[model samples]
Target chain A: MDAYFFPIIVTGAFAGIGIGLLGVFIVGMRMPFIGSCISHTAMVGAVYATLFNINPTLGALVLSMLGSAGVAFIPNNRKNLDANTGQAILLAFMMGLVFLAVGLEQDSRSEMLSLLWGNVLFAGWGTALTTGSLTVALMVFSLLFNKELKAILFSRSLAEATSMYTHLVYFLFLCFCGLILAVNLKAVGGLLIFSLLVCPAAAAYQICHGHKAVVLTSMLFGLLSTVIGFLMSYYLNLPTGACTVLVSTLIFAFTSFSRFVLNMND
Target chain B: MKNCVALSDILIKRGSHTILQIDQLTIHAGEFVGLLGPNGAGKTTFLKLCCGLIKPNRGNVRFQNQCISRIAPGRIAHFRKHIGYIPQQAEYHAHLPFTLREVVAMGRNALKPLFHALDKTDYEIVDSWIDKMGLADRGRQTFRSLSGGQQQKALIARAMVAEPQFLLLDEPGANLDPNWKKQLRETLDRLFNDCRITALLISHELDLIPSACQRLILLDQGRIVQDGPKAQVINSDFARQLFGRTITTPEKP
Candidate 1:
């Protein structure tokens, strides 16, 4: 069937959908920096996995999740040493990852570029299956836990008093974030996955007040970015991953500026 | 002091500095404990320790015959469900969108799981508490929209809505005028009169301590230098030494 590419495209769209789902939690917590940090850190992990001849996705997933949790654990209120500590730790870890990749044989460099830049045009049916399953699981979790998440986000101590465990909820959220991040590496690559996660949610948040509405609109925003980015890349013969990210960034900026103008008029 | 919350030879340290050293303390329930301490007297820290919000490096806070920690967090919620805590000069509650009724519903927050939507009956209970506080018309108003006096009253209603068995407020009355303070104290008296809700009000202002309170616990330099009935502690040498000034009760006006 010449239309065989349709299902594969649909599978890639699942990654687009995950963008909307994860975006709400990221923006709600006011922790978009956490998403940015984990994404680049996953790249380092991917390169390390390549050197060891391991499943690079697994390496990226575990390291990104741990890095997310570790950032949360750092005491930010002590003096002026808040995000500075996170920046230092992330820098050191990224350097270590680069060095490990340098130690690999020179012949593997071409293959490793696929993981870094993404080769969405060459995506196979198996990649589709992986992306599909991850997106489904995330959808189910978000639907079931939305109410509980809302209460905890209000106040940690108040949530604890109400018998809601903030630590457990936060940990599960990171794990879910890590999974989406790992799968998206196949499409947008690690360095650019953040736009898929942050931009759409931010744009949605600008217009929508309700949490569920924010999630839905963000998914729509993400899908629009993906389709437009894909067509632009195909027509211009540019790198698909970079095009997708740049388009999403433009959409985000456009929406944000419009909201700003509207607010000023009011 | 008899049937008291006693701390025998208590030692509290903060990174090698022993902040509080106490040989003994005896405070009975149902007494309005005006916990007065100068700045850095560890008043807030002591109150937090009593609530088990933070664990001491050593020594324990006890009530009656049982320790607070051995009690489950659920049971503590049940215990604190009855205690209304007013933090000192509460500054952060402004800008919230919730109506006074919704803010009061936060007291019931200690009741159950996050997903358990508070039903119609819970709203009615909160509505009634507002009516009881003489704010029936203003009940629909958001908490931040009210004057400082009204906000404190709304907060008190929030704290007492679960009909907490004990009420712990920290310097909440500092913002209001003398008349408003009296109104608040009267409201508290009426609110907790029938119930056995033990009240512990924290304030830096010594004169603001309600006359209805039978006992006064004077804290200075992280130690309880004076603990006695209002008349005994008022203008006593122990009170003056703890205060670092001669004790003259504020004019009634």
Candidate 2:
């Protein structure tokens, strides 16, 4: 086995579990753009950190956190500036900043682009540590607040009427998504990480009828996609992030097909 | 007896529009009241205030003699557990993954502690409500798969599983066919057999309001136009104007 094989396996586990569970919340709430918004903010932060010679991960983490909270805290009743609108505006602003940061540090231009496409083969133990901790924290939160999450997924207004602080719950959930994206920034890259957060969960949604089933199936799909895609990339000398995203997309297509066939029989 | 819900100088405004303004009102304990109003009459807004989901801009809302806003934020869940709120049926998304049983079980979520699984008693309560609502076979079916009336029945079961002291229904019968509407009326009547549990049902359909509600409260342009016995209020010109026709007695089964 190659010396990098162990790191690859660990990184796969980290990205799979963290993004998979977080995907359930994102998909259940029907907000796919949240993934894009958070990842783009992370990209801008990474570029800025590269220009300043700082740890890119820390900068990415802080900016993405702000972006997530900005989108989540938008009042639900606002017709002009809802969550989706806010996220789109933030994403556009971050994209502009990312380019500016890249241009400012012409010497580090490749370094900034590296964050966009990722180079997971050289991802150090720190990547594993960040992803591992984030996944664990998210799992604990999901366990403790299962009921509240279910209520919110069913209907935010009804949940609030039950005297639950649904707005707080929603904001915290988005923040966790941001944290996960930040932690996985190097392993999957900003552009492809959203695929990891969406495709596996979407495939799971086609086959699972219950909440618990959907979450578990999504994690299973994510892990399988990551491990297989990582292996394919290693043997073929291809990009790990693109391979992983493609695998997830294939899985979603398969599940959709199977669901269609099953429904036809009924 | 103290009022279950009391409002004083209540003003509900959205931007520049003062949607609802109530000088004073009291819902006594153990009374079934029907709220009648036209579109945009702020019936739903009033129910929201009563449930403490929204705070009035310039007044106090007291529940059981204690102001809702004054209670510690953490303790509000305890207060809310005693009230059942069923929003308009249209609020439910058809694609939600909940089954009939799961929907009903949500009623008990507020009473249980966080992270705790449903105990045997919780399941028993959930099952009882499903059965009582005539959804015995539909328990396993997804909420979206059921007919409109069945879905509404499941929602009612969800609200009642808590055995709330106050039940607030917001036009639960809208968008239903005549047959389904009759079934809904019967189901509501059966659920309110105990006079100890007060109820305030909001509806525009005169024929759909359950016969058990003794008092009728009418709202027009956000103010209470009439509040009295059902017979007296139903005969008024305001009632005719609200309904846009001569009011006839609703038929009894």
Candidate 3:
């Protein structure tokens, strides 16, 4: 294997694990759209940063935080707009900003295009370290707040009524999710990362019956998808992002089919 | 007895329409009260107000003499630690992978500090409640797999596992069959009579109310129409007109 491939593989692994863990919450909460929204918002930040000669990662981080905060704090009530509607508005606004930023760029749009369809082959030691660090942070947060997160996922209202500091926990979880997506936006294309953030978890839930089992299985599937997808892309000389998404979708399809067969047998 | 919850000049509005309007109401500590009203008569709204789940458009809801609305949003959970609220329908996603044990253990989450795991004693308490609710064999089953009545029992177990000082149940018996309803009544009776846990139970059917609940409050069109002893409220002209028939109070268990 080429030496440069080491960093790319490491980055893919970390990104896969981080997004796979986050997918459980996203899918459990029925907010898979959040992955798309945050990634696009991060794209807007990255393009504008490139246009202004600033650090695209920093811009992505800041704007994605803002997007997550909007989703977290939006009043979900009968009189006011709900969180899903708020997220849709944010997503549309971000999409518009991304296009405007792209149009305003005077330099070669290669960097911006690479972000839309990620090229993990260009990843370096720095990218691997950042992804690794963020993925570790997510793992620690999940461990520390496992019970609280479970309660919140079960029902935010019930968790709040039970005095679980639900708002704070949920806000923190969203902020972490935004941060993970922002850092991985460059390595995993904005267009394809939502699959990594949702598919593995969806597949895990298809076959797993308990929370711990589902989370662990999701992480395993995430790791397997990225590693296998990377090897396939390297051998076939295909787009790494598209290959990863295909692998993830296949895994989900396989799991769903297995679950269907088992239920039929029962 | 000290007042547990006091609502004064409480007015709750959704948009321009009024949902609940109560001038004054007090529930004393260690008292079991049954709340009765028609489907849009604001029973759930009243319970929500008492639990600080929603703020009223006017007036105060005092918990242990502290105004809940005046309490900061972050600090309201501190007050809620003493309350176990069971809504009519718990918002549960169909695919959530929580077991009955974990669902019951959530009650302990409120009492413990952040990041603290449920200890053996907590699990023991949860198990005892599970047994009491007659779900001893289904601890490992996913919450979604339970029948409607079984799920209700699990929720009741969840509420009771906390040993909360106050419980607010909304139509807890709505999905329960007669046998389970009888068990629920006995459980409520024991909790209220023996443990002295102040409780407000909302039910559309008068038969679901436990025998130990002495006070009854009747609501109609967002107003408190009757508040008194159970028999008095049931036999009142207003209740008779509301039910459109005479309702003989059920024999005490």
- C-alpha lDDT score of every prediction, in listed order: 0.67, 0.81, 0.85
Task: Itemize residue pairs with steric clashes in candidate 1.
Answer: B4-B27, B82-B164, B82-B165, B83-B164, B83-B166, B86-B169, B86-B170
Model 3: residues with Cα > 4 Å off, grouped in runs: A78-80, A264-266, B175-183, B240-253
lDDT of 1 by residue, A72-121 (tens): 56543333565656656675667566556856648788656766666576
lDDT of 3 by residue, A1-266 (tens): 99879988888898888899999999998877777788888888888888888988898999889988877876544447666777788788888887787777758488887777777787799999999999999999999998899888877778888874788889999999899999988877777888899999999988887799989999888888888888788889888888888999999999999888778210
Q: What digit string (tens of lDDT, one per residue) describes model 2 on residues B41-75? A: 98988998898877788899888888985566566
Please tell me which predicted candidate would have the highest lDDT against the true structure. 3
- Model 3 lDDT, residue A52, Cα: 89
Candidate 3 lDDT over residue span B134-230, tens digit each: 8999999988788777777788788888888889999988877788787778778876776788999998788788999999999998999999999
lDDT for A168 (candidate 1): 62
Off by over 4 Å in 2: A165-168, A264-266, B70-75, B89-93
Candidate by candidate, in order, the iRMS in Å equals: 5.1, 2.3, 1.9
User: What are the per-residue Cα lDDT tens digits for candidate 1 across B167-199?
Assistant: 777777776887888777777667656565677
Residue A264, model 1, lDDT: 28
In model 3, pairs of residues that clash are none
lDDT of 2 by residue, A1-266 (tens): 77768777787887888788988877876767888898888888777888899889898899889988877866654546666777678778887888788777878787787788766776667767767888889888888877778777776667767745566677788899888888788777788888988999998877776678888999899888888888888889887888889998999999999989888210
RMSD of 2: 2.3
What C-alpha lDDT does candidate 1 achieve relative to the native structure? 0.67
